[model samples]
Structure formats: C-alpha cells, structure tokens
Target: MAYSTTIRRRRRTRRIDRAGNPAAIGRWLLFVAGLVALMVVVGGITRLTESGLSIAYWKPVSGILPPLDAEAWQRTFAAYQATPEYRLVNRGMTLDEFKSIFWWEYVHRLLGRLIGLAYGFPLLVLWMRRRIPSGLKPRLLLIFLLGGAQGLLGWFMVKSGLVHEPQVSHYRLAAHLLLAILIFSLLLWTALDLLEPRHGSRQRRWRAMAMVLLLLVVVQIGLGALVAGLKAGYAFNTWPKMGEHWLPPELFALKPFWRNFFDNAIMVQFLHRLNAMLVAGWCLLIAVSTWRFEAPPRTIAAALALLLLIVGQIWLGIVTLVEGVPVAIAAAHQAGAVLVLALTLYFLHMNRRTAHHL
Candidate 1:
C-alpha cells in the first residue's frame, strides 16, 4: 500500500507537469506575437521616417548593437552617404540627422534578434526537457528560421534602393511584408492550436470563407506595400475618386500590362483602393454568415469585430491618403491592418475548430 501510494503521487506529479507545458508554450507564443506587433509598428516608423536604408550594411551577428562611439557613427553615416537615397533625396543631410534614421532601423533589427532568442532558447529547453512534442519541434524551428530569414530579406530589400533606384523595389517590399504577415499568422494559428482542444464539430464553409478573407487581406496588404514603395499615396490624395473619376486613365500606360499593377503609382494606388473595397465586402459577408449560422460564439464575435475593424481601416486608409500619409494616421492605418489580420486569424482558427468537431 505504501509503494502504491508513492507511485500514484509520482504519476500525479507527472500529470501536473504535463498540464503546465502547454501553458508555457502558450505564454511564449503570446510573447512572440507581441514582438511581431512591435516590429510592424517600428517598421512603419522606419518607412514613414525614410529610415530603412540608413543602416547601409547588414551584419547579422555584429549589427545587433548600435554604434557606441563617434568613429563608429561616422563609419555608419559614411555608408549611408554612399547610397542613392542620400545623394538624390537627402543630399546634404548631417550626421546627426543620419543618426536618427540609423537608430530606428537598428532598433528594428535589435527587436528581431531578441525575438529570436526569446523564441529559440525556450524552444530548445522545452524540446530537450520533453515538454514539447516531437512533432511540433520541426515546425516550430522552421518558424524560428523564417524569422531569421526575414532579416536577411529585409537587407535584400534595402539593398535595392541603395543602387540606381531612389527607393526600394516594390516587389521586394511586397515579398517582405507578405513574409512577415505569414510569420505572424503562423504564430497566432499555432497558439490557437495549443490553447484549444481538439474540435468536436466543424464548419467547412465558414472555414473556407475565413481563409479566403485572410488571403484577400494579405494581397491587399501587399498592394499597400507597393503603394508605399512607390510613394503612390501622395498622388491620389482623395477618397472615392481618383482626381475626379472613380478609375484613373490608362492604368496600363507603363506597358506589359502587369507592370502597371506592380510599377505605376496611379495604377498601384487604384488597385489598393479597389482591394480595400473587396476586403471590406468579404468581411461584411463573413460577419453576416457567422451571425446567421449557429456556429461557435467566438467565430461570430470575431467576424463581427473584423467587420467593424474593416470599416474603420477603410476610413483610416482614406484619411491617410487624403491627408498625404501623415505619420500618425499612416501608422494607425498600419496598426489597424495588423489588428484586422489578427481577427481574421482568430476567426479562421475558430472555423477550423468548428469543422474538426463536426
């Protein structure tokens, strides 16, 4: 009886330990999501302040720390001066002004590094301790690696503007933004998986719609990035009309047809506006579908919240564009986008859960 009691106690201890494992993983996921959110805001500042190309060099290992002395600062500034941005845009910028932009990009990189450590060290510890399932280790490590790759891709994006071009490649900018959003979506989705139990029922239709909305949001964001890359927002400067008409003249004036969508400011901005309308329409549809159907309350709530957010985001976009992409409004517009992405992710996961149960 004594031995049996000891065995039972040990088993209970193991059970408790097992129970806490998921919560720890959940906490880490939440931390990563928060960090990604900060990265997005900082990224917006980098772009709005035109600070992205200030660093001029990518030192993945050594660049984590900003310059400490005047000599180091001069070297960094000298590199920036060599870039086309400095020659064409900020021809006579002082070192002090250069420092302002340098710090923003530096901080952006630093946050990324910290996020890696915060994710990786804990992940390794958990895996070694058998707290993380064997199956999850590979997927989680891929996420960690993607975060690292994002930094490299960022450098690649910056390198484009440092040459003949006055600004970064819109294509690279779109890819970078898409990658970041994908990382955020993956983290949030994984967190949902860990937080919730196996599904008892499923809603396939809503799930499909949720995913479609997500893809539309991502595409819209990519288009928005292209608009930013080209500084296209400055051209439109109005809501519901593009310089007096709903559609601009000769969207394919740039030639090859697709180049207009990717390269032309007027066409790119026009597409962004159109994409926003499509996203808002999809959100409204999802909201109505979720409300009318007898699915999970979370799904319904997420859809409704997303609908409201979509409306506000559209308004913010108009204000930002009409107001000439002012820093505050532009930043808010970007923040609103991330929020909408989060809500869509939430609803999609909920839909997945509902479907699994069914």
Candidate 2:
C-alpha cells in the first residue's frame, strides 16, 4: 500500500510537470469550439430571417465592408434586386429594410472570416513553437482544410437559393449543416483528447450504445436541417400527433419513396419526428445503464447532462412546432441539438477509457 500510494503521487507530479503548451492549445481549441457554436446560433437566425442571400455576391476581400453611403447602398440594393428572391418575393423592399437583412448575412460571413483567421493565425504560432503534439499535427491541418471547404459549401448552399427559386435546396442545406456539425465535433473531440487525455485503453462499458447514440443524434440533426430547409414545421402545427394522427399519412408521398424521406415536406417532418423518438429512447437507455454500472466521474456527469439536455430538447422541439416555429424558439431548438451533441461526444470519449479513478 505504501509503494502504490507513492507511485500515484509520482504520476500526479509528472502530470503537473507536463502541462504547458498542449494545455494552452487545448484551451484555445475550446475557445474556437465556442465560436463555432455561436456561429451556428447566428446562422439559425440568419436562415429564420431569410437573410442568407442579402449580399447577392461572395466577395472574399472587398466585401468585408458594407455600404458606406447612399450611392454604395443603392449599388448593393441594385445587386440584390437582380436576384430571384427580390423580384419574386421582396419587390418593394427599401434600403433600410435591405440593410436589416444584410447585417445578419454580413455578420454571419464576417464571423466565418474571423473564425478562419482566429484558427489559422494561432495554429501557425503553435507550429513555430512546436507546441502541437506530433500525432495531432495532421489532424489539425485536416480540420483547417475542412474549414475552408465549409466556407465554400456555405456559399454553394446560398447560391442555390439565388437562382430560379427563392428557397435553398434542402439537400444542400443538410449537407452544409452536417459539415458544420462535423467540424464542431472534431474541434471538441480534439480538445478533450488534449485536456484530459487517457494514456492507454481500458474496458469501455456501453461503448456500442454510446456510438449508436452519437450516430442517431447526427442523423436527427440532419433531419432537422431538412425540416428547416423544407419549411415543414409550418406545414404541421400540432404534435404528439403530426396534425391528426400519430403517424403521418404521407410518409411515402413521393414516387420513389426514398425521395420522400428527403424532398417531401410532410414526409421529412415525419421522419424527423420518428428519429427524435429513437434518439430519446436510446439516450434514456444509456442513462439507465450508466446508473446501473460502474462509470467514471466525468462519464456520469456527461450522462446527466445528456439526460437533462435531451429532455429539454424534446420539450423545446414540441414547443417550437406548436408555436409555429417562431424565430427565437426555433433558434433555441437548433442550439439545443448542438448541446446534446457536445455531451454525446464527451460521453463517447469518457467511455473509451475504463478508469473510474478520475
């Protein structure tokens, strides 16, 4: 017992001795993860307000500044006036009205630009200082590249709405959202790996359950993107019953049937609802198993967080649906998904190691 206690003390001492650069980098990644979440919230607002296509053009550099004077404002408005959205829907929108929508998209894009700089500049300094873990260097580079691809994807999604139709493609919207979530997940997982990293593998309990939950959450979130893209929430205002019955009658409305899952508005909303039930059930099972088994401190905390957040998310989704998808409520619903995913990632990371010691 005396020798074992001394070894534990030495291990703690060594841990303290090893905490400088990687720790700072971990904290930095957390900060970046936060910015990503904020951007998701703002993106929700932008979509809810229909401000995504306000700028009418993607200017990587010169577009940073909004219109400064009446002439510039008119020119910008003229540009928007050329789009299908202006001609078909917002024909008589004034300059001040234009500015209101413009700011949301502007801030959204501006935030994206700022995030790029925030990540890239600090990363360069870290590389120069040799602060990054050797194994993590490639992962960080891939994340940066993915970030760039995300920017391109955002514009691509926006461009679809600029063409003949006044609405963006639901498929493209789902892709964009999924990619953003992916980036956020990677940023978070990487940060956790650095901050409270495990030294070696242990017997992970309920590992399969956690993986399934994570996958279900991702699919459910994507289904949500479909709901938002198709504006399906507006189609059905009653829940626990999607209009009149527990099952939507139009689940296979499209000819191919599979297309109904993606393109049909009513069908999309139904699948999203169905998927939510699976996610909730699976989460409850995980929570129970964690309570019944011997789980680590962090894992237990993560499970509780998931339970609370998942319950809140279900309630929020119902409220959002019944309230006719109001901007504030709908945006909160989207943010709720992010929170649930964050906890799920923590749970998965925690389950990978068998130690209950920490």
Candidate 3:
C-alpha cells in the first residue's frame, strides 16, 4: 500500500503544461515520424529506379557502409549479377549502370537503419532515466517491435523479386507499404496524444467523420501501392477518362474474376482511380462540415490542411499517370500520399479522446 502511494505521488509530480511538451518524448516521436516519411520517399525512388534488387543482400550491420574499393564494388556487382532481376531484366547492364541503381537501394536501407537508431537510442536513454511516462511505456515498446517487423517484411518483399520474377509480388508490395504507413500513423498519433493531453474537441460526430476520412485515405494509399507494384500507372495515362472510354474493353480480361483485381494492371489502375475519387469526396465533406459547425480554430485549420492536401494529391496522381510515371513525378506522387495521410492523422487526433494522457 505504501509503495503504491509512492508511485502515485511520483506520477502526479510529472504534470504537463500547455506551453511545454512532455519531456521531449513527443518531439522525439515527431522527429521519428519525419524519418519514416523520408523512408517512404526513398523506397519509392528505389522501386522507380529498378534499384530495389540491386543490393542482392541484407546485412543488418555490415551493409551500413557501401562498397569502399574497386574490388569491393566488383564483388558487390557480381552478387547482383547472380540475381534473377539482373539475369532476366537487366541482362547486359554495364558496371556503371549497376552502380547507379545500387546507390538508391543502399540509401533506402541506410535510412531504415538510421530510423531504428533514431527511435531506439532516445527511447533507451529516456527509459533508463525514468523520463518516459508510465502510460506510454508499453506503447513505445510495441512501436519498436513493429519497426523490427517492418525491416524483416521489407527483406521478405525483396526476396520475392530475387527469385523467378523480375518484380516483387504486388501483394507483398502492398503489405510492405501499408505496414510502413501503419507505423507512421502510430508514431504520429502517439506524439499527438503526448503533446496535447487536453486537446481535441468534444464533437464526437466530427470524430467519426475524421475517422472515416482517415480510413478512406488509407485504403486509397493501399490501392496506389498496388498500382505501383503492378506498374499500372504507365498504362492509363488519360485524365477525366481512361483512354477514350470511361471503362476499358479489357477491364477484367483475366480468367478468374478476382485475379483481375490483383493481377490485372488495368483493373488495378481503375481501382486506384475510383478510390481516389472516394477519398477526395470524403475529405471535402469533412472540410465543409468543420466550417458548417464552426469548430475551434485548430480544428478548422487541420481540416483545411487536409482538404488542400487531398486536392494536391489528386493533381499529383493525375500528372504522374498522364506523364507516363516519370521518376520525379512518380516519386512525388508516392511521397504526397504519405503527406496526405499525415494530415488526415492530425485531423483525426484533433477530435479523438484517448486514455493515455501523462
């Protein structure tokens, strides 16, 4: 009983103030969220450049430094040459070309390592110092585990391409991308919860609306990932319609009907297009609702930000597809999805009531 009372007193002593953040933990999480967003952008670059399979190996520790010498470069290139991607897709590619792709994938992996360090190092220090809030301890641990799992899943996705297929499985690709988004969302949400313990409006209706919009955005993001995995954007380059018709003649050309949704490039692109419309419509509805009800200033600001993001994301997607998925536009389009998701998360947290305030 005495020990319990002492623990309660300790918790009470570490109170939060509106002007300040929670012992740098919330800020640290925000910084980690930024790194995850960068990782997503770099992942897009790695895929677009056909560089994902260039590395051909996953050395969690030793791969930190790139090939340092001529002999090292040659050995690394030789290992890549043994892969199915090199043999089937990039056959006869020169050493200089191999180096170009190798660097993108290397940087991608390096960012992952850096993110892990960025999150883990601070968490360890804070934990040892007993600065972390008791309510957030288990949540942080879970986030760390998810980060480790994401690394393993990334390698699993890469392994698929190192075999017979020159490209990774679209299913694995979508799963990998969604998992990254999940981690990012979790980080962002936790940070918000810590930073604003007394935040959020009392409007439960707006909370539901925000949640629905967030789900729509997440689903649309998954569809975009599927489109990328299937290389669907390169085909459907028309705006307002799909190449002279609202529906293509071969929309469902695959034998099994469901396979068309996953394996058929045309169908995948169509789904992505349709989902984007749904997401945009939902965002508009929520933005207008926030104005109609005269929500708090911060709430309206978050909604307005989300509204603008959806519009910009729609334009980016169209330009990317119409321009035949140019590397720069395509990378921006992928990055834009993360930005939209981040803003949506902010909007959701504005109205969400959680039990984990410190």
Between candidates 2 and 3, name the one with more favorable lDDT: 3
The residue ranges of model 2 lying beyond 4 angstroms of the native Cα positions read 1-20, 199-203, 353-358
TM-score attained by model 1: 0.91
Model 3: how far residue 286 lies from native, Å: 1.1
Angstrom error of the Cα, residue 37, model 3: value is: 0.3
lDDT of 3 by residue, 1-358 (tens): 9999999887666543322347377888999999999999999999998899998889999999999999999999999999998888889999999999999999999999999999999888878767776778888999999999999999999999988978898899999999999999999988888777677577897899988988888889888888989989887799979999899998989998889988999988998999888988888888788899898888888888888888988999899988888999989998999999988888788787653455
lDDT of 1 at 128: 74
Backbone clashes (count) for model 1: 8
Ranking by lDDT: 3, 2, 1
Winner on lDDT between 1 and 2 is 2
Candidate 1 deviates by what RMSD?
3.0
Among these predictions, the greatest TM-score belongs to 3
Model 2, position 150, has a per-residue lDDT of 95
- For candidate 1, give the lDDT of residue 229: 88
Judged by lDDT against the true structure, how good is candidate 1?
0.83
Error of 2 at 355 (Å): 9.8
| lDDT per residue (tens digit) for residues 46-95 in model 2 | 99999988989999889888889999999999999999999999999998
TM-score on alpha carbons, each prediction = 0.91, 0.91, 0.94
